[model samples]
Target: ILIGEKRFRQQSEDPRTSPSHQPEAGITPSPSPRPRSPDDLEEGEVEEVCEICTPPSDVLVVEGQVVEPFSTDHAQRLIGQIMVLNAQIDRMQEQIDSMRYRLDSMQQEMKNMIDVLGRI
Candidate 1:
């Protein structure tokens, strides 16, 4: 059917409300309740294709590997970097625990001084 044909539909059979069937243009209606992969919408071309054979600049070829810049770089970094960052996080947590313990000790010492002053 041609787009802008202006066919009024209803939820059941009334002519007032359109029940949202599909676009009149040839969009090829996706199957109902279909589980679609991330590669389905762009059709798994791996890299963006400008021409019939030309690839876009967002991807790169390094050591015979096609790497997507945004998707592959941060998501597929080396495990050594991840381990280093995790170690830093662990060290920061230990520092925080140490600071909390020191603060608690100082608070207790202040309480003891106040009690001694009250007795004198």
Candidate 2:
């Protein structure tokens, strides 16, 4: 992604106006070590730049450009909802477990009563 953007920027740049053509930031130009030009970039460097710049997301087509389907706020809201739902599910599971235990205890009590009647 960075490579694509850099290439686009480089392509659009007039040869005279590129950062390579401009002086170094904060430091004076040295006669010994030359500033690295965009053209000096290796294919591997470009690939690494793309790897670094690309973010993880589900691709969505909005009009012409590829973008995220939902805004950050909407995604956060959805995440909160999901967490609430998960908590509810956990509570339901606990209730189900308690109910099952009570039912088993009741069944055992009923079996004891039946056994007592049979002996009598």
Highest TM-score: which candidate? 2
Clashing pairs in 2: 1-50
lDDT (tens digit, per residue) of candidate 2 on 11-37: 223465555444334333222333345
- Output the number of the lDDT-best candidate: 2
lDDT of each: 0.54, 0.58
- Residue 17 of candidate 1: its Cα lDDT? 33
> Per-prediction count of colliding residue pairs?
0, 1
lDDT of 1 by residue, 57-90 (tens): 2124468767566655575576668989999999
Write down the TM-score of every candidate. 0.38, 0.43
Model 2 poorest 10 in a row by lDDT: 50-59
